[model samples]
Structures are given as structure tokens and as C-alpha cells.
Target chain A: MNIYEIEHNREIVHPNTRMADVIEADYRILPLLYRIGIELGFGEKSISEVCCESGINPNSFLLICNTYLLTDYSPSSELIGSANPSDLIKYLSSSHSYYLNECIRELEGLIDKVASDLPANQRDLITTFYKVYRKELENHFSYEEDIVFPYVRRVIEHKEENEKFTIGTFEKNHSNVDEKINDLKSIVMKYIHSTGNRFESMQLLSTLYILERDLMKHTFIEDHILIPMINLLEQSHDSQ
Target chain B: MTANNKRVLIITPSRIVAEGLITILTQAGGFTIERVISSISRENENLLHTIPADIIIADPSMFGFNILQTLKNRLSEFTTAPLVSLSTMPMSRTIAANFDEHISMFDTAPEIVKKLRNITIVDTSNSEESQDNNIGELTSREKEILVKVASGHSNKQIADQLNLSVHTVITHRKNITHKTGIKTIAGLTVYALLNNLITTPNENL
Candidate 1:
């Protein structure tokens, strides 16, 4: 089976499940764990124990983990109710930092190295394409951070409803920031075959694929977990 | 030196004009002047057909009164290569319309390079889009649906507009997602923009 393929019978991560075992199940969860503020040195601690130590809500942590790990997993209203919006926001903000500061910065460096081995026109094309993608990604994340996140925080904390802005507004404008990366990958694969350093190009492509997958997951969390949770909050506030 | 360098075939009767273009294009970079011919006649007609070129820069004035007929009959084999008018003198609008692009003597090196690059880039990308098999080029019907989807139309709306069943629209959308490897509507919009399915971002959005 493909590593990313959802297995119906695969064990789900529970509060009592060993944190180490979660990583062993799929190493991809390491980034998720890191974004959620769960550090290493769990030392046989259960998920609940780690959450307790980190001052995280165990139920919310499990919801995020199961949602991310299991492709078929959909967060029910109960799951959304159990998740703390502030915790989700913190996790998502950290994920944005990971993508912008760490992931894309690394990609920019790799692409530059790869471009060094290509012809001048191809080099300019690849570099310019990547720069446009990076700008779009930065804009996407900034919209969320500047507009969406702050509004959600205000709604949660002060119960102050902004008639002008809501999660629905976010849902409408939430552009697929990951699609351009897919285009860049295909463009490179199709056109950039005669590069001097094949290894560096391969590294760049692999990093792009990883970033695409991670961005999809991040968007999923925002669409499914974050949106529904905020929608529920909005409905409650409206009824009051 | 690379294959990416666009092959430019200069066809002008004046040696000074041809040499000047060669110097400018060489300085501007990303172009290789493949051949320079002073004039085309029955003896040299075969040379035009034999030489491979991505673009053709020709002086229409050299063809005299019957410029359009001369171009159509003589350069019939080079339908794929964009014929750019290398304007040394003021030309009529009707005569100018025969060529794909125009380059004036007053134009700067960067301006000339920009015009050439625009034509080459669009020409190469169109050819690549058709020839490339790995990306699974979208069919006309699929492209039509992609435009609708990129414009933020729902499956039901697309079905209504295109006079198809909702189920058929859904199936077409699924195939689009599969072929493009893009799931989100925003992603599809960007794809449409990149592929020139939609001319501008705000056109249908």
C-alpha cells in the first residue's frame, strides 16, 4: 500500500496510546507533533501524559492527530466541540511558521542550487515561477494570520461578532495555495530534464511534493476542524 | 548555446539591417540568429523550407507592392514560425497586419528582446502543451468545464449552463481533478490562469 493511503483497519491514536508508537506508526506525524508543541523525550509517556505535561487538551490533540493521520477520518460535531479553538489556532499558527520560515525558505535554497545547473532561460523561468509561488503562499498565510485568525480569536475571547468578517468569508476566499506548487513540479518535470545536477533537482522535486502534501493537510485542518468549530461558535453567539 | 535559445531566421535585403539585428539579438541574449538571407527568390526558396526556425524576422518592404501575396506563397512552409516585421521605414497598418509582431528601428534592445521572447515563450508553451503526454492534456470539453470551475461555478450550475446533467458535470469534474492532480477550486483557478484557459484572473472570478 502507498504510505499515504488510508487503511481502514489501521489502529487509531488514542489518549492512552504511546507517543513513541504514534511516531513509529508513521514518521510523518513528527511534524504534526512538533507543530502541536509536543517535544521529544516522551520516554514511554502516553499521549495524555504528554498533553498534560505540555498543558495541551488531550482530546483536541487526539482529534487533530486522527484527522491528520487517517484520511477517512472526519471530525464529527462532538469532535469539534471537544477541540479547543485557541489550541487549534496555536497549532495552525505554528504550522504557518513551519511552512513560511522553514519549509519554503529551505525550498528557495534548494531551487536556487538546482537552477545553478540549468541554462540561463530555464534558470530564470524556474526561479521566477518559484518566487511567484512563494509570494502567493505568503499572501495566503498572511490573510489567515492577519484577518481570519484574529477575528476567530476575538469571537472566542470577547464574543464580539464582526458583521463584516466571519469564518464563511474565509471559506469563500480560501484559495488553494498548494496548486501552484503542483504546476511548478509538473513544469520542471516536463521541461527541466537536462540539468547539470540531477541529485539537487530530485531533492527540489521531493521537497515540493512534501510541501504540497503538508499544505493540503494544513488546508484540511482549517476547512474541517477550524471552520466548523468557528461556525458553531458563530451560531451560538447569533442565537444568544 | 543551449537548445532553449530561440532560433531566429532574419530575412532582410539590406546587409546593414541584418547585421544590426544580429548584434542587438546577440547582446539581448536567449536568441541564436540561425541564418540571414538578403532576399528570397526561386533559387533560394528551398533554403527557407530547409532551415528550422522558431521565429522569422523579415522586411516586408523588400517584397514590394505584393507583400501579402509574396509572404503567403513564399513562406507557406513556415506557418508555425511567427513572422515579425522588421520595420526600418513607416509601414501601412494593412501591410503590418500580415506579420505576427512588429519591431521598429527606434525600439531599444530590451524592447526588441521582450517582443521576441513573448512570441517564443507563447509559441513554445503552446507546442509543449500539445506535445507533452505526461501531464495528460485536457480535452476541449474538459477545458470548458475547467473554465467554469475556475470561475467558481458549482457542478449543478455548470450542468445548467452547459446543458448537461449534474451527474455528468460531477464526473467531468472528477476527471479534471484526476488529470490535473489539483483538488481545490482555487488550485484549479490558478491552473486555468497558468494554462491560459482564462485570460485574466478577474475575468470570470
Candidate 2:
């Protein structure tokens, strides 16, 4: 967390540690290294050598690589180009499961529970908004999982072709799910008067907050870590 | 709430402890002592919500009130501010885990200020990149300009404040941005937060 201490130690990357050793220590970072275009079976070479070969800032690269060890999420742009996309892919996939399976499902039920107490017109409007948002979220996740992730995998697998597709395409399509969720939060917090069921309102607000925060973290990992790594790959491919 | 000045809310039962902190903080300058509440009672509980603080330093056991419970109850309001638990005993593990920090009362005033400065930086901002702690090497003039820039002042405003030409202000900003690789005001704001050039904004509430 302290960047000065990290830089002054003269230990940006462990000079002698092999890629295999790094993966062995924490398999979670495996995709992170891969996103940086480092081959998984990287011939026992040190990270410094790989960073040098790839033209990445070693200090910034290692900071992102070590982020898996942090218990709490803190956003940092330093890891942008140096992240391993596959590592991000792995982390992001699980997050997708949590959102689609748990968060959306739970929110749908809560929205229904709260809507039951409202006027028919008001209930219909609120439910319609929730439905539209849920669909949008589902579609966003599907695009990443189906199209973007497959493209990234092909690049990682070294099957990249001279195609117009790039991470920039994904970035352009990326939706801020958090903003929609915030709209939902404002609707509930400010507009929806409590119908003597304070408990339902509180639960709805709390759920929205968790979804908002979690989605923000998820998008950050994509925008900051995954996309940046993919862009690095695209640049290298261009020079080829 | 003072719009520009950073406020600190100290919750302690002891009058002497509260006054001693008020004196030290006032001498530090630039800090406005929001209030020193003797207990986390109904009257004081209202203050926690009314007066937004950059930092809240409290003794959880001073009045036998669970300060953490009070914080947890209104977690959203206090999310951006750093919460420090000052006590003699080994801080409860939960306090260490939950609060932004834990410091002993015996710690020096400078140490407390340092902790406050560190935690005030908005970690959520993508500008968490450190300047490698290079704020030390900045000239006093550059530091002054950098502080102004970080606090959302325009170059023209900074020039007028420091009695410098806009061109000179721009040059200092370029040097700072080049040295730090942070050209945006938000990034510089975080840099200022780290170096204690400005206090955490009180409008987070």
C-alpha cells in the first residue's frame, strides 16, 4: 500500500524467482501474469527478465501481481498494462457467478416483496425498471463471458490472428452496471416511501449498496487490470 | 461544518483528554476542532451525523459505550472518514480489523497527524499510485502550488493566492505532474492527501 517503501527496497521484482515459482506460490495470480502476455510455462526465467522483454514497469507490475494477497480491494492503475489477463479472467469469472446467481436473484425477490405493498401502477413501474436493469446486467455478463473472454483466451493461447477485434472493442461495449444500480438505489432510498415495512426498505437499500460496490470493484478489475493487459498484447501483436 | 478546514471529532469521557487533544490540534494549525463530546449519548449521537468530520478519534471504553457499534450503525455516513481508536489497552482485534487505524494515547502529536494524513487519501480513486514519497524533495514554492492544485484551485487562482504569474504556476505544475506522472487534479489531490498538503474534504457526508 505504501509505494515509497515498495520502490526504495530495490526489490521491484524478485530477480531470481522463476515464473513457475511465482505460480506455485499463488495460483490465483496465474491469469494475472498471462494477461501481461507472459507464457505460463515461461522456461524458469525471472520476472525481471520477462518484464524487460515485455517493456513493463517492474514496480507497477509487481504491485498488481501482489494484489491478490490484499484482503480488501483498493483500486490502483499501476497494474493496468502489467496484469496477467488470464489471472483477471479467473477472478472475474467467479465474480460473474456471484452477480448472476446470487445478487440478481436476491434483488428480484426483494423487489417483488416490496412491490406487493405499492399501488398497481407504481408497482408495475418499479418492477419494469428492475427487469430492464436485470436484463442489461445479464447481457453485459454474457458478452464478456461469451465474446470477450473467448477472444482473450485465443490471444493467450497464441492463436491470435490479424483481426479488427481488440480489447478496445470490449471497452467500448462495457456498461457501468453500478450506475444503473445506483439509479435503483435512489428510487428506493428517496422516492419509495416506507409502507410501514422499514425492514424491507432497509434490506433493499443494503442489497443495492453491496451490488453497487461489488460491481464497481468488478468493473475496476476489468478496466484497470484486464483491459490494460489485453491492450499490451494488442500493441505487441501490432508490432509483429 | 467548516467548508475548507478539516474537522476532527474526538469522543472521550475525560475532560482532560479532550482538552489536551484540542490544544495539540489547534497548535498544529489548519485543523478545526469540530467538538469534543464527553459521551456518546443522545445529544452527542446527533452531532456525529450533523458535523461531518475528516477524522474521528474515540476511546471505545471511555464511557463504556461500544463506539464501534455506533459507527457500524451509521456505517455509510462514516465510510469515507478515517476512524481512529485511541486507548491504553491492547486494542480489541475487531477494532484493529474494522477501523481505519488504532493508535495509543501515548503516541506523539506528530505521529497522530501522520496517521491522519495517510488515511485521508481516497483509496477508491484509481490514482493510488504513490509519488514514491518524493514530496520531500519538492521546493517550498512547488509544495504550495501543488497544494493549491490538489485542492481544486485553478492555475489562475493559485497564481493570485501566491502572488505569482500564471506562467510560473504552470511551470511548477508541469514539473510536479512530470515528476509524479499524475496530471489530473484528482491524482494530485491524492498526492496532497498522502503528503498532508491538504486535509480530507469534509463534504463526503
| Top TM-score prediction, candidate number | 1
Residue range with the least summed lDDT across 10 consecutive positions in model 2 chain A? A1-10
The pairs that clash in candidate 2 are A31-A86, A31-A87, A32-A84, A32-A87, A33-A84, A35-A84, A35-A85
lDDT of 1 by residue, B1-205 (tens): 7888998888776677877888898898888878777655332443465666889998888665453666654564223567899988998888887888999888998899999999877534333222222236677877998999888788899989988877556656655654666655655665676566885554332
What's the lDDT for all of these models? Answer: 0.75, 0.63
TM-score of chain B for predicted candidate 1? 0.59
B46-158: candidate 2 lDDT, tens digit per residue: 24655657788877665333436655444332224567777757755765666678767798998877776676665544322222223346677678888777677888999
lDDT measured at residue A233 in model 1 versus the true structure, 0 to 100 = 90
- Tell me, by DockQ, which candidate is best: 1
**Candidate 2 Cα errors over 4 Å, as ranges:** A1-83, B1-205
For A7-117, candidate 2 gives per-residue lDDT tens digits of 111222354677677777767665455445566546867877776676655544565555443322333444455455665676577668777887788888888888888
TM-score of each: 0.56, 0.41
lDDT tens readout by residue for model 1, A128-236 = 6677677878888898999999999998885675579889899778756776777667655544664577887888889888887777778778877898899999988
